[model samples]
Target: MQFFASLVRSVYAATILATTGYAPSFSGDTKHNAVGAAKAIESFHPESSFETFDVNGIDHPLSDRPEFSLEDAAVSFVQSRLNITSDAVAFRTGYANDVIQHAYIHQQINGITVANAVANVAFNKKNRVVSFGSSFVQPSSVPSNTPSISVTDAIAKAESQLAGEYNGHPTTLEFVAKEDGSVALAHVVQIQDDDQDMWVEAFVDAHTGDIVHLTDFGAHASASPVYRALPLREQNVTQGFRTIKNPQNKAASPIGWHNNGVTKTNNTSGNNVITYVRGKGGARYTTPQSSAPLIFNYMQDPTKNPNATRANVHAARVNAFYVVNTMHDIFYLYGFTERASNFQNTNFGKGGWGNDRVEVSVQDTRGKNNAFFYTPPDGQHGYMKVYLFNRSVPMRDGALENDLVVHETTHGITNRMTGGGTARCLQTLESKGLGEGWSDAVAEWTEWTNATITDWVFCPYLKRGGFRIYPYSTNSTTDPLKYSSLKTLTEEHRIGAVWGNILHNVYAALVSKHGFSATAKTDPKTKGGNTVFLHLLIDALALQPCNPTFPQARAAWIQADANRYGGANKCTLWKAFASRGLGIGAANRVDSKKVPAGC
Candidate 1:
C-alpha cells in the first residue's frame, strides 16, 4: 500500500509541477542561539560585556550610547563582526522616542533567503548599540546548488508523507538550513489538511525525495442534545425557549436547538469542537443526555432540579461552541485563512496548513466563576476553560456568558496572529496590555455585530452594575481612560482598559460615519466601518514587530490601513488614535509605564 501510494503521489506531483517555472523558498526549522549571538556581540564590545543587561532570551545588550545609527552601523557590525556569510537585508526598522532604534534583518544565501533566520538589533539614543540578537543559520560549508531529483519528485515525496487530504501545489524551491547548519535544496509545498484542520508547509529534499521538514501552520475546532439554556447573555431579563443556530451543520439549514446535545457523548457529529464535562473533582464523567431540544427550560429557574442545573450547564457549552465557530467563520470571511490560525479539524488543503483547534472545557472548576484562554506556540492547539458559577459568590456560570467566551477566544486569536503566530514574541508589558485590550475590543465588536447588546460590558452577572471599569460607548466622557493612563497603571488588565476605551471610540466614530449595517452582520463579504475596523486590526497583527509598544502598534495599524485601503481611513484612524494619546508623536519605550503623548 505504501509503495502504491508513493507511486500515485509521484505521478500527481509530476503533473502539477510541469507547468510551473520556479518555486519560492518556504520556512523551515532554524535553531536560534541567542546566547551565542550575545557572546559574539560582547566580543566586539568588551567594555559593555561586564555590565549586566536585561536580555529577553531573544536579544542581547551591547551598549547604551544614544547616537548610534541602527540601519547603517548595526547592520555593518553584524555582517563584519559576526561569523555569518549570508548577505544581510534590512526588512523592518523603527525607533521609540530617544530610547532605542530597532532593526530586523533577513539573511540571504545564493540569492535565496534563509527561512526563519533573522538578525534583530537595537541601539540606544547615545549612539551606542544596546541590544543584538540573531536566529541566523550559519552553514559551515556550501552544498551543490543543483538538485539530484526533480521538483516534481520532491513534491511527490511530500505528498506521500501526508496523513490527511491536502490541496494546493508547491509554492517555492530553495535550500533549507537545518538546526545543525546542514542545508538541502528542497521544494516547499503549501497544503491544507482539512481532516486535521491545519495549514501545512512541507519542505522536501530534492536530491533524496524525502520530506526534510513539515510545518503545521496550525489547525485552526461542538454540541447538543436536549439541555436547558439561558439567553446568550445570562443577565438578560427576557427568558423562555429560544432557537439558536447550530454551527456544526454543513448544509444550508443547520440544526436549530433549545437544549444542548443529550445523546452525543463527544459532540463528534458537529466536528468543529469536542466538549467534555469534568465535574467537581476534575474527573471526566458522564452527564445525562436529553432527547428534547428544550435546554432553555432548565434556566427558567436555577433551583428547579439538579438535572436542570446540569442541563443549563450543557446548554451554555452548546452555545459557546456555536459562538466560537461563528467567530471562526466570520474571521474566515475577512481573511483568517487556515494558514492564518483558525479553529477547524479539516480544510482538505485548499486554504494554508491544520491541527490548530480550539478545545473548550465547560465547568472547569468546582465553583470558580472565571474564564480564560491559553494560546500555545504556533502549530500547537489552544484550550479555553470556562469555569462553573461560584456557589458562594454572585457570579454565574462563565460558559453561559457569550461576551466572556468571545473575549477569551479573542485572546487566542491575538496571541496566534501577533509576532507571526508565535506566543513567545508578545511578552513586553505594553504587549501584554495590548493583548487584553484586543480581547475586550473584539468581544465588544462581536456583540455589536450580533445586535445582541447595546452597550459593551464584559460581564453583567459578575457585577450587576456592569463589570468593566467603564462601559464601551460612543461618548468619550463615558470612559476617559487614554494611552497616558499607562503611566500610572501597571496591571495588564487595567492597562488594557485604556486601550479598550480607545478602540471603542474608534468603533463609535466609524459607526457614526459609515452607519451600522445589518447586512454586514450576516454577510461576511459586506463591507462596513465595523468590518473595516476588524480587517485593520487583524492586518496590524501581521505587521507588528515582536514585543511591540503602543507607538509600534499604532504604526502597524496605520500600515495595515495603507496596505488594505490605500490609506483611505488614515484621517479617521489618526483622529481616533490621537484622541487616546497615541497620536503621531506618541512614543514610549517597551518597558516604560509612561504613555506617549499624541500629536
Candidate 2:
C-alpha cells in the first residue's frame, strides 16, 4: 500500500555504486498478501472528504460495544474487515484533553515493524473507536530481515543523497514498505542543513544498499503548529529560540499550519497567514520550498557592534507566523467561525468567502517600537506589520514580543466579527478606542499565567517599565481608572486603556473565584474563569451593536453569558462588571459601581 509523502530521489549523472557488503535479498518469488482494504473503506464512506491517507476508513464509530483499548479493537478491525493478518501491534498511543485518544499500530514482519506500514485508530472520551486509517503493505514478496549492508554503511549511503549537517536527532533501522506493495529492510536517517532548512528523512534498502525512499520534511508539513519565541511572560534573558509545537484546535485549523486542504507550503505560508520578512536592503528570508523544521538558532556575537545583520530574521518570521496562526486557532474557539469571516485563504466549504488570509511583514520598517494591522472587509487580505524596536543594545523585534503580535492580530478578529465581516464598524472615535481596548485586553489575557495574578503591561520589553501609562491592575491606587476616564483622554491607546483595564479587573475577579487554566487558550472545552471571560469577550463582540459604548458592551457580555452558559455565570458577570463601574444603571460615561439589588 502507498504510505507517507511523495518520495524525492536524487539522480547523479554518473551511475552510483553501492557499498559492497553482504547481499541479503528478498525472496521475490513469494506471494504477498493482497486485499482491497483501502478501496473497501472508500466504498463504505463515500462522502467524507478525507485527508491524505494510505487507507482511511473513519469518522464513524467502529463498534457499538465499547472496548477497553483502541489498539486491540483496531487490530481486530483490520483483520476482519481490512483483510490483514494478526501481525499488527500497537506502535504508539496519544491522548488529548481527557476527550480524545489516538492509537498508532504498525504492521510487523517477523516481529520487526514496517515503519511505513502505519495504521491510526482514534476514539472519543466514550472509548468507542471513532476513526481508523491504515498503511499496511501487501508486498509481492517479503524481504529477509538479515541485512546485507551494516547499519553504519546504510547511514553513509542514505546521507549521500542529501545535503545537510546531521541534526543530532536519532537514526534507526526498520522495514520500509515500498511502492507496488513490496517490502524492504532499510536504515532511516534524519538530517538538516546549516540554515536549519531542508529537514530530510531518507530510507535506504538494507538488502541492495540502494536509497529506497526519501522524504523532504518541508514538503509534507506536519499536522500541528509549532512556534519558538520568548513567551509573553518571559523577559530579556535571551534564552534563544525554543522548538514548541503550539496546540492546534481541531475545529479551527484542521490541517495545522502551512496547508489549505489541496496543497501545502514549505515556507511560512498557510491557510490563516502568509509570513515573510521583506529583508529591506537584502534578500527576503523564510524557510525554503523544502520540508524543514522552521528552526533558528542564530546567536549574535558580542565582539561586533549591533546592527541589522545581528538580528535573527528567520526566527522573527517564524515567530510572527506562529503567533498569527495560534491567534487564529484560539479566537476561532470563541465564536470567530469561518462564517463570521475570519482570515483564511480557503474555508473548506465551511462558510464565508476565501482569499483573505493575513499577510505578515516581520521586522517591518514603517515604525519604531510598535506594530500595526490593516484590515479590509471579508474576502480581502489583512496586513500585519511588526517593526523593529531600536530601544535595546542589539535592537528587538516586535515579532518577538508576543503581546504586540497578539494585539495586532486582534484587529483582524474584532474588525471582521464586529459588523458581520464588514470591517467598518469600529471606525468611529468611540468604537476605535474600544477596538484598541479589545486588542490590549485580548493580549493581556493571552499573557496571563496561572502562577500569580499581577498587573499586565503592553509590550514591556521595549521599555524598562511598560508601554501603557499604567499597567492593568486591580488595586484602586495603582490604576485608578474609571469608565468616564475616556472622556478627557484624547488619544486612542489611553482612551482604550480605561476599557482594557476594566476588562482586566473583570478577568482577575473571575480567576479568583473559578481559578485559572493554562490550557484554556487553545482548548475551549477547558472550564475556568479565563475561559468564561474569553467566551464572553468574543461572544459579546457579536452580541453588541457596532460602535457600542461601555455600558452597551457590558450588557452584551451579560447576554452572551445567558446565551452560552444558560445564565450560570450571570451573577459573576454582574459582579465583575459592577466592580469595574459598569453596573446596571451606569451609562453615558458614568462609573456606577453597583450590581443588582440582591448582589
Top candidate (lDDT): 2
Please give each candidate's TM-score: 0.54, 0.63
Please provide, for model 1 over 1-599, each residue's C-alpha lDDT reduced to its tens digit, 9 standing for 90 to 100: 01111223355433322221111321232332111111100000001111213433222223343444556665664553343332444444555565666677765567665554566666555555566655554354446667788766665665556543336653676665554446666777765544334456766676787665656565321234333343333333223435543433232112222112212223412323445566566654433334433232334334442224656555556656656666665666666666776555444354533555677777675446577788886556678887865543333656666778778888877887786566776687888899888888887776564322245777775555555688776566777777778888888888888778878877776666566656553465456778788888888987898878887888898899899989877777887777777776676522222223331
What C-alpha root-mean-square deviation, in Å, does candidate 2 show against the real structure? 16.8
lDDT of each: 0.58, 0.68
Q: How does model 2 fare in lDDT?
A: 0.68
Highest-scoring model, TM-score: 2
Consecutive 10-residue window with the lowest summed lDDT within model 2: 38-47
Candidate 2: clashing pairs of residues:
139-181, 217-291, 218-290, 218-291, 218-292, 219-291
Q: What stretches of model 2 exceed 4 Å from their correct place?
A: 1-227, 232-240, 260-262, 279-285, 289-307
**C-alpha lDDT (0 to 100) for residue 394 of candidate 1:** 34
